[model samples]
Target: MRPIGIVSILREQTPAPDRSFNFLMAAAGNNTGNLLFTHAVWEHLPGPKERIGFQFDPDKVNATCRAVVFPAANWFGAHVDLADFADRVERLDVPVTMIGLGAQDHDFTGKVDVPEGTLRFVRAVAERSRSISVRGTYTRDILARHGFRDVTVTGCPSLYQPLQPDAERRLLENAKSTLGPTLLHSTRFSARYRAFVDTPSIHLDLYRYAYRTRSDLLFQSELEEISLLVEAAKKPDIDDALIATLLDLYGAASWEELQAYLHNSARVFFDIPAWTQAMTGYGRAYGTRLHATIMALNSGVPALLVHHDSRTREVCEFADLPSLKASRAALDEDAISKSITRADFGKFLKTRGRNQETYRAFLADNGLL
Candidate 1:
């Protein structure tokens, strides 16, 4: 029987000693958060499979594989460059399926300027599949506008990563437990988008809370944080300007204090299992990174998402995850405590089960099951 071909790096192929930041970024598709869903998709698909790169040959793939699967990210946006990927997909002859594809925008206004290449990519996949799995209603709506109605809102494959049958009950129990020192999945400030204007304040407040409580800080794609980790590991000459900028941004008291936090409290993981295992130590997790929060939940740690854009917000709403918008979130000690306490775990469990069934049906329809 022919195996399916997955468009992802299932695990860290690069050895630890030789893994530079560029290699890590490439393995993660430029963001460490991508590992969550991509790994989930890889896990859920049954039978034999081969990991294929985007530069694959159509003739070889059609001859060797039954189908090809894409565990996609926020591909529907003006900023994404998918011209080469679209061309590759267009040439593929085997059945194609995409899971957890999403549209990125500042808000859920349904006004996204998708590039022509991305549109072509969507069409090519749609042509070869029974249905396309999307992250939320926003993504479904975006595809609907392009005249593709066969879309399913599966939230994200990452939500289905945990193997325990009683995972939802455990997650609920964990959420109700007394709060402890939290893990902050931090995001840095960016001026490239309008939604990022509120990022600094949200991140600063989270950083201050983490500092006061002695909680660890987790970084995903931020270059400055990665640089600090690289410096610590390699013993390189420190970038003083980068440290100063981060110190100011995060409201650290001094360079020494910031250094202490970086050395002791900051963490970046290149491996998915290690990252999920680390989340188990934290009583709670909250931040702007969606997959980081999902990782915590997968570890039976309660998590709250502070969503800044439609890409994050739509999934939170669809999955029934505990969330507060960055614009409306009050990050004070009392507010944060209340937000975590007020999350409706019962409702979340109910919605999660329904979404899981939908996801399984999607896979079955696409002949992946």
Candidate 2:
């Protein structure tokens, strides 16, 4: 059987022994959360597969694989430049499928200034694919505005990573069980956009919650956090200046306390299985990171998304995942417990089962299953 070609950064589940921070960042595509979805697309696909990276030889892929699949991120935004990717996809002779493509913006009502390059890229994918699977209706609508009609709302592939008939039942059971030590998934604030974005306050609130409860906090894309993890793992001491910077950024009580927390409660993972295993120990997970929340769900742990942007909001709604707007979510144990209690797991399970069928159909139509 011909192998499927997948676009990804990490070639294997485990990192090399000599893996540097830069290599880990590359594997994660600069965000550790990326491993969740990319691995899902890689693992969920049927048959043998080869990693073809972003810049692949199209002729080689056509000769060697049945199809080339791109597990995408929030590409429909002004911040990304997709011309180079578009150029490569335009040369492919085999079928192409992009899964979980999303549009990023401040809120659902905000319009994205789609780049011409990204538009070209979408056009190229649309031409090559039977249909493109988007994360939610917002992304489908965005592409619809661009004149593409073969878009499907399949949410993220990570939601179905469990690959079990009883996955929904397990998740529902976890949601109803007694709450345990919560895992917090949050993004560190960017100082450059601190004034314009609400992420800063949200991060602070999450950080405070994690600190007060002494619950585990997971870091995704922040370079400083990654650096701290590396330094803590390798050396006797982390840089004092770096610790100070993080203290200010996360509004930590003190440098020593924060450093202790980094060594104790903070976590980052390169291996998806290891991360999934870790999540199973947690009773509940919550915060602003979408993929992280999905990871918990995939592990049969209940999670609540604190949607601060369109990318997170639309996907949560599409997947029937319980969520609260960042503006409305109070970072307290009582509030979080209340939100989780109020969640309609029955509805979520029904929607998720239907979405799973939709995803399977999408894969089958694209010749991936």
Candidate 3:
């Protein structure tokens, strides 16, 4: 098997000189989730592995690998320069398979119109590749409208990752019993974005709910790490404006108090193994953090997603993972308990297995497997 080039947001470094500061900040939370699917694609394909540089050079990449794999997300958003990315990818003559691509939306149900730049990118991908793997029905439909019929509705790769079934069952039993008081609440409050109008309020509501309920809130995004670094006076590159914005978004009176609060009642994770390790004793996990909920599900813990936008909602709906819309109204413990009890791992895992087969077929049909 010839090496296949994988190009993605692989956040494999701290002081990443290759990426922009904004990209690095976003990657802190997104990289692992993206890699969850990318790695699965790599293993599925016939290849000796070669990670293509984030800096896309067509001739150099083509010379090294048989094909290129792009694990994409929310490609229909306004923030990314899809035109530039398409232009660069167009220069490559190798086969490209874009897995788990999606479009961002303002709400859980509404769809954002795809821009010309995004359409161009999709066209370029369609021209070079066999089929594009999408996140859900919404993304598939969006591409269909733009004349891309080869799109496959493969749910995000996070749902199909490896899990410890026996270990998870024991944890679930503990949750069902009275021995576990610990609840995991995942929230994302720090990011500069324009698509979701209710994201900040939704996060604030989740934070308040976690605080009132005494749940151990978890932070997965880079902003959490950035805040920790700034507090420790370790991130010398961060500007005062960025620090002020971060502090304001953190919703704390002081940096020390924020640190104290997190240290006492919250936990931060940088990788999957440590995250699953931490999930062992927790009774339930609930909040807007999509992957965090998925991680819990994969770990055998009952979890619920507080879906604030289209991406989370569609993925949950497709994968049969338990989820609810983001609301400012307070959610009582009784309601939370009901949702947790209703989470059926047996059903969800069955659906996940089926979706994985479909995803594998998609890769095979495209000549990757």
Clashes of each: 0, 0, 0
Stretches of candidate 2 off by over 4 Å are 11-17, 163-170, 174-179, 189-200, 231-242
Off by over 4 Å in 3: 11-35, 38-46, 108-111, 167-175, 181-200, 222-226, 229-255, 328-330
TM-score of 2: 0.91
- Alpha-carbon TM-score of each model against the true structure: 0.90, 0.91, 0.83
Q: Residue-wise lDDT of candidate 2 within 202-298, one digit each (tens)?
A: 8677876787777899988766655667632232234665555556655687977877887799888878878877876788888999988888776
Worst lDDT run of 10 residues, candidate 3, spans 229-238
**112-171: candidate 1 lDDT, tens digit per residue:** 998888888889999999999999998899889988899989998999886444557667
On lDDT, who's better, 1 or 2?
A: 2
What lDDT score is found at residue 238 in candidate 3?
A: 41
**In model 2, how large is the Cα lDDT of residue 121?**
93
The local distance difference test score of each candidate is: 0.79, 0.80, 0.67
